[model samples]
Target: MARYVVIGGGIVGLATAHRILLDRPDAEVTVLEKEPRLAAHQTGRNSGVIHAGVYYRPGSLKARLCAAGSRSMVEFCAENDIPVRVCGKLIVATEEDELPRLRALHERAVANGLPVRLVSPAEASEHEPALRCVEALHVASTGIVDFTQVSRALAGRAEQAGARIRLWARVTGIVTRGGEQVVRTTAGEVVADVLVNCAGLHADRVARLAGVTPSASIVPFRGEYYELRPERRDLVRGLIYPVPDPRFPFLGVHLTRMIDGGVHAGPNAVLALAREGYSWGRVDPRAVVELVGHPGLWRLARRHLRYGLTEVRRSLSRRRFARSLARLVPELTERDLLPAPAGVRAQAVTADGALVDDFLVVAGPRQVHVLNAPSPAATSSLEIARHVVSRLPTDRSPG
Candidate 1:
């Protein structure tokens, strides 16, 4: 029997398994992935920007890990000979009214121990000539890298460390038999001394299936993006972002320069009709009913009705979306933006209407469930993995 069974072969699970093997090379680890390959969902589809420790409250898990992981991930990439660039990110405040919020953001970054600088409008323009802003906070530590490449490398490391990755293996049930866990997967039954669930989109469902209930439900929010028309890709030199609205839990749409040297922009967070729905046509009635049934969803909508309405408006109206970008870069016209791929976030919300702000982990006698891992999880994979593995019961021998 394996020592550990890691469910969901995304970055977190693979990183956890790899880290376990790193500590105890003799431990047998098996990673069960529902998809054909790793990171095919959120991890693979993300914007590929290594987030700076900006936007999160100081001293939170998100703050601690994002900053530490930002450095660690960069080192891992360089050490592994993966292609990466330390092209910093710019959070531009386009309006006179937005400057105060930008300053608050800068103060948070400072509190979070990130090396950030306040750049004047003229100075901000020096780096991004076409961008217009009252001011911008330049995070020298923020950078861009391909998370998929990093994930593949981590998977390779895990394999080299003696961890077995089983693909297209959806875990249907997890039940403890006597002192061990019976992980019923598509491949076959595997009994192990320990289990870890790192399912991103279906994390809550996975936990429920595993007989652990958390307070929150996962709601899928679709983030839509548009690439700058090829003719005007020069509008963004690196990453450009607007000050996000505080009313909503989401960090509003922003422009990013991908590691592949392409500029992509806008990930407007809107309610998706289906859990995995990428386009407008793919709607699941059950998912819709379940999404609507969550009291948190209703409470969140009621509390942020105006903000919710605005996001829906932007989703339906390209002119409105373009206007949002125009606020930061006046040079970009509606015709200059073209449709791009969308990424749906697995946003967890409390029944009381609070968006789970930081990482949530629950530990059992024989298992651990990663309930909610917010943004930068991909960036903080190794550190988060270290944390997760350390929580496992060390006294138990392999089953």
Candidate 2:
């Protein structure tokens, strides 16, 4: 039996562990999570939208994995009795200037083999009654699901397969001795033949600890959201997104109809003070200092100073956020939206100031580190697990 230790108990880690147990029935698999419970960070905090291979560059890992994962996720949700809605999504162009981008996205989606179509204003209105769009790309495979529920299901399946999950076992150090790894944790020490790092926000740190040099640094970007008041929920029938600006990494402020029967809006991306900073008051001095000292961040900020300043202004003003949403649904107003929880994304930024666009995986002897996995990661978790497992050595001896 091969001993496998996976750090981080988010959906990706749990999914990887589940895949290991499925492949090697006699494998000794253990998951260590710093948090008391699973999915404490990114997996639990994201806006539960299952992407449909749109926007990503065709043939990229994100495009391929997301396309395959979308189908697989729907099947998994059905098998596990998890609630999921394939309500579709509209990438709308409110003005003539955005129409070219909208068409380009539609072409990209089609090239990626997704079921996408360019919808006229009347056609878009039929799907979302209040939406005002000159043109829109209707992505039929786009859906929503509760990822926390999915994580729990994955954990349950892994546990049933004889995998052990230790909560609050924060990994403090890693030492490779001979052919095995000694993972020192807050609770105790664990020895394993192989280690997989799926730590989302702190992935780069984990890689460094494991003696691997990641090409990019993890920069936390906080996405703030607001929920539609109960009565105002009727305005959004499904997901309504703007034609994203090709220059920025973010998918501008949009509205989503969540799986739990609530509609959420905004989510303007801004730099967070801490890795897990969800609010302005939760700033960490060390994180702030590190960010300020990073030359890459300075370069990125210098390039996108105006856009970053706009995001900051929007984050501070409800009216600015409401106006962005109004571009999608003219009926929406500031009063109709209430403050909702926020999510922080661990975006990978290269030393040259460019955001790492694709999924980045760094490997060392007997270990693999998932350095960059944002947005569609939850949707792509299963495929990512399979891909990671396939990369492992095939000649390892059974214990």
Candidate 3:
């Protein structure tokens, strides 16, 4: 049986290990996570909305995987007795200028083979009574669930399948000798015939350690959120989103009713000082120096300077965030907003400063590194695992 070592214990990492065992039951699998607990980073910090393949371009990997994974996720939750809800989502267009963009999004959704329809203002209000929109795209298949719970369930299933997971085992070094991989970690040394890199925020660095240069560098972006007070939660019936700007990858501030019954709003994206920087007070000098040295960072900043400034303003001011969310639900006010934890997205940017919009997986001898997987990654975790497992090397060549 081949010995396999997988890095990171987030949902994708756990799912990958589980998929590997399903495909090769006799293989020995070990997962190493730096954090004391699983899903400590992006997996645990997201808004937990299972995307319905609405915004992706036609014929893309994200489109295909997200569409399939949504079904699989709901099925998985049902099988494991986890709570999940297909609450549906509305992408609202509040102004006349946004109507065309909303219509284009609807066309894209249809082209991607999703069940979506364009609804008028009255129809939109019927779905979300407090919402104020000129038009909306209703995606009935969109759903909500706690991804951290999903990650825990995945770890349990993988462990039951004879996979060993070691918490607080941080990988520090990797070496290749005679077709085997020698991995050095905080916990101890591990030897494997194959290695899989699912390190979310530090994926590119992990790829470099394994002697495989990634296609892009990982730049962290902080997405801050606020939860609606219990009294204001009723303002949001389900999920309310804005017509995203075509220039950026982020979906602008909106409202979501989480599976746990609380309503969350505003995840405006801004530059993060560190890979795991969730708040402005938390800063890493090394991360800042590295970001300053990267040419892509400068280029990206120059391109989105105005938008970046606006996001910074929103981040510093609760009133600004409230005003942005008010575009979707007119009843939302600053008083109803309460502080919520933030998540940092691991986005990949190329040398030319173009943000990677699709799933990026780079391959090496007996190794595969998932370079970029931001939003929808949690929604598409199982499918991503299958994709990664299929790409594992079959040869006995040295890693």
Candidate 4:
């Protein structure tokens, strides 16, 4: 039997291990997590919107996986009794200048085989009564669910399949000995015939530890949110998104109705001071120094200085953020927005200063490292896991 060691206990790692055990029942699968519990980082902190493959370029891994994964996710949720809502989404073009890009996005969605429709202002208002738009693309496959719950289910199913999960076990080093990979962690050392790194935030570092040079560096972008007051939740029927500015990497802030009936808004993207930094005050000197020293970050900043400044302004001023949201939902006010938890995105920046726009995976002998998986990652976890597992060399003898 093969021995598989997976680093990171996020949903992707759990799903990968689960798939491996299902495919090779006698294989020994072990998962190592740095946190005290699974989904403690990106998996738990995200906005929980199931992407409908609307924004990604056609034929990209993100586009393909998100489209297939969204369907699989709903099926999985239904089968496992996980709460899910296919509430749909409206990507509005508030200004005439944004209409061209919105049309382009609609074309991309069509090319990707999503059932999206371009709606007029009236149709858009019918879907979201409070929304104000010149034009919009209605994506029916978009929805919301509690990803933390999904992660828990995956963990439970993986454990049931005989996979061992070690929590609070931070991987310290990896050594190759006698044709087997030995992973040294805080809890103990684990030896495996194959190692898969699904380390989201520290994926690049983990790749380096495994003696592979990744093509990009992980730059954490903090997305801060505001929740609508309970009385104002009715303003958003499902999800309301702004047509993203093509110049920026992040999807602009929008309103989303959660599975639990709460509406969240305004996740303004800003450069985070730490990998797990949820707030501006939570800074890590090392992370700051590393980010500052990165030539790619500097180049990225130079190219998008004005937009970056705008994001920083929105991050600091509640009124600014509310104004941006108000462009989509005219009735919303600054007072209606309350502070919500923030999520840090593990964005990968290439050496030449371009943000990696698709899912990136790198492989070495007996090892696979998921280098970049940001937004839609949670939605695409299972499919991404299948892709990762398929990439592993199958010709190796069982250790």
Per-residue accuracy of model 1 over 1-399 as CA lDDT, tens digit each: 338988888788888988999987888998999989998878877888888889888988888888898999999999999988888988998879988899999999999988899999899998899899889999998888888888899899999988889998998988888878889988898888898889988888888888998888888888888888887888889988898766565777788888887888788888888877787787999889988788888888888888888988998888898898888788888898898888878888999888898888788888888888857898888889988988887747531
How does candidate 4 score on lDDT?
0.91
Q: Against the hidden reference, what TM-scores do the models get?
A: 0.97, 0.98, 0.99, 0.98
Tens digits of per-residue lDDT for model 2, 1-399: 688999999999999999999988888999999999999999998899999989899999999999999999999999999999998999999999988898899889999999999989999989999999898899999999999999999999999999999998998999988889889999999999998999999998888888887899999999999999999999999999999998877899999999999999968999999999999899999889879887789999999999999999999999999999999999888999899999999999988899999999766678989999998899999999998888766545422
Question: Where does model 1 exceed 4 Å of error?
Answer: 397-399
Give the per-residue lDDT digits (tens) of candidate 4, residues 1-399. 788999999989888998898778888899999999999989998889999999888899999999999999999899899999998999999999999999999999999999999999999888888889999999999989999999999999989999999999999999988779999999999999999999999998888888888999999999999999999999998999999887666899989899999999968889999999999899999899989889999999999999999999999999999999999988899999999999999999987899999999987789999999998999999899989988887746431
Candidate 3 lDDT over residue span 20-70, tens digit each: 989988889999999999999999999999999999988888999999999
Give me the runs in candidate 3 sitting further than 4 Å from their true place. Answer: 395-399
lDDT of each: 0.86, 0.92, 0.93, 0.91
Q: What does candidate 2 score on TM?
A: 0.98
lDDT of 3: 0.93
**Candidate 3 local Cα displacement, residue 106, angstroms:** 0.7
Candidate 2 regions exceeding 4 Å error are 395-399
